[model samples]
Target: MPAPNPACASNKTEPSMLADSIDALLPQTQCRKCGFNGCLPYAEAIARGEADIDRCPPGGDAGIAKLAELLGIAAKPLNPAYGIERPRLLAIIDEDACIGCTKCLPPCPTDAILGASKHMHTIIADLCTGCELCIAPCPVACIAMVPAPNLTWTETDADRARLRHLAKQQRLTKLEAEKAERLQRQKQLLSKAKSAKNQD
Candidate 1:
């Protein structure tokens, strides 16, 4: 797991009090089954009245009841459009089948899949949030989810996963910024070269 962020672990925000409370109740799967980026984004949307509270399939009917109680609204059934709640599943990679394509690495919010191009990949069982986002990207179909009846998402597990997800998001954002900066410099250098050539 990555470093801890109290804001993410506690789901307490200094701003957007309502959203923070809403997020605190969410399972923090970071699964994106809610159709938003993650639990926090979904909570923010709910705070803005832009989304329904029933989209969290990982949270199931019990989760919906908690949200409804929090919002003082009537509890509704889990929205089938998102997914049906079932036993928690953990992703496992078949090493023999994995082509080392490194396709599934980017989609994992928790950074659970570890691998390099032309090398086999593996899942970090404790770190994986079981988001299922990694399954579709595997060209070789080496990734699959198994029911983890013994490993339920306790608060600690969710907190750890949330921290990893937050850290990964931060890293990706920084890398994107660096890429954009490099591109800008390349553009400037090319323009300067054109001006210099024209003067000659």
Candidate 2:
């Protein structure tokens, strides 16, 4: 996704700008259980009157309450259509079973999966938000969601996850820009070569 507009960021009091703040309050799981691509998108939808604030299952009742308070509205139960609140979970890859097709890597919002193509992949538990976004893409069915051992979800954890999500987005954006520049350079070279051949 593109970076949030700087012009929009400057006007912090706008209703849509409030959505950016709302996005920060979210868990940054990027799970899409809220019927959107990520927490930011869902927050934007909420700001635009297109979605309710109670749609995040990862946020649970407490998250809903916080969102309600921010929006100055009554807190409601989490919409079951999205998902149910549960203990925080982590993705564990069965290394032996992992074919290492790298399918699970891209869906991870936090860049928690570490490995290269055709090599064994491992999950960085500390960075993982337990979004479960990586599981569905595993063609080998090696990924499993297990309850986070000896850890509880907290605002601090959410903050860390949010930071990781932002970093991942920035990395992806940079990669895309570089790719575009490379393609443009290739096009220019080809054009120059074609002109030279025509002159000859």
Candidate 3:
């Protein structure tokens, strides 16, 4: 018989262990501005009652406040040692200035930069999450986040509502594609079964 699923193994008896498990589920961005080794370790520290909730910069005020509620602690100011939260951005590379030393490439979590050493590199704007992780590593400082102009706020409620509507439609399209893939797989399985029966 196959071994039991790892997820099915019990942590039910240990409530603290359950919290640690929850902490482990967080994205591990090792930016310690969280006042810990990384998000997970800070989360684990919070789970274990060893750290305050307001230390995570990436999580920002919302995350800290949520953790405070979860742990029955008062929500406090974000620790100043960790940097302030910045608006989301897409990094643009100045191709003319980019020598492509590749120092910046290692820091980008999304692999958005394209080019080789000693050549011009460009950012794939669509792929960049604008985490600002790449800005520090650039030897030439050619990459910088500029707010995407298309998303800039307009004075009209109609435009804002329209943008939301478009985003919803895109999400629906993605869901439909996933549903179609599932149906296609089911059809293929049925066809294979019918052929096997005929052969038998």
Candidate 4:
């Protein structure tokens, strides 16, 4: 479909911005459940009026309504081409039948698999969000989706380390921006105070 023109919404705020916000709430599985490349870009199209809000199966009805509200558009029925959302599942490797091509490793979003090349790999079920982002990447078809294991399943330190690092970076950026704003405010206050003193 051709993209929505900026004039599509009469409201001051453009639809693209609201669509981006809605996209952020979606799972980044790239499953095409929404019939888009990924959640982020689809959100832009939806925001811009190029796509329907009901296309995302993962978001279901709730997502569609939320997007409509955000964009000031009417809520509509979901498009069935995307398929229904299912419960979380993890890809499991049948160890005996496995020929370790290691193709699955690169595609795993959470780094749930553990093994070297030409060696058997195992899925870390706990870390898996059942996004199914890993399935098509496996050339062997050895990977099968099973119910995700319970809470006891754990990811290695590497995963935790990376997550923490990214979080800390974000926090630092926020703090820095706040500090700069505070300093600017203080400078303005001091200048105003001096001006008043001079007038006195």
Point out the worst 10-residue segment of candidate 4 by lDDT. Answer: 151-160
The CA lDDT at 94 in model 2 is 99
For each candidate, how many residue pairs have backbone atoms clashing (under 3 Å)?
A: 0, 0, 0, 1
Local accuracy of candidate 2 as per-residue lDDT tens digits, 1-200 = 33333333344368767888889778888889998988999988777666887789989998998887777677889989889999889999999999879999889988999999999999999888899989889998999999998457777877887788889899999999999999999999999999999999
Q: Assess each prediction's global lDDT (C-alpha) against the native.
A: 0.84, 0.85, 0.60, 0.65
Any runs in candidate 1 off by more than 4 Å, and if so which? 1-15
Residue lDDT tens for model 4, 51-73: 76777775667667776776677
- The C-alpha local distance difference test score for the whole of candidate 4 amounts to 0.65
- In angstroms, the error of model 2 at 169 is 0.8
Give the CA lDDT, 0 to 100, for residue 94 in model 4: 85
Model 3 score (lDDT)? 0.60
What's the CA error at residue 126 for candidate 4, in Å? Answer: 3.6
Question: TM-score of every model?
Answer: 0.89, 0.90, 0.54, 0.62
Q: List the lowest-lDDT window of 10 residues for candidate 1.
A: 1-10
| lDDT of model 4 at position 18 | 70
For model 1, how big is the CA root-mean-square deviation? Answer: 6.8
* Candidate achieving higher TM-score, 2 or 3: 2
- What TM-score does candidate 4 reach? 0.62
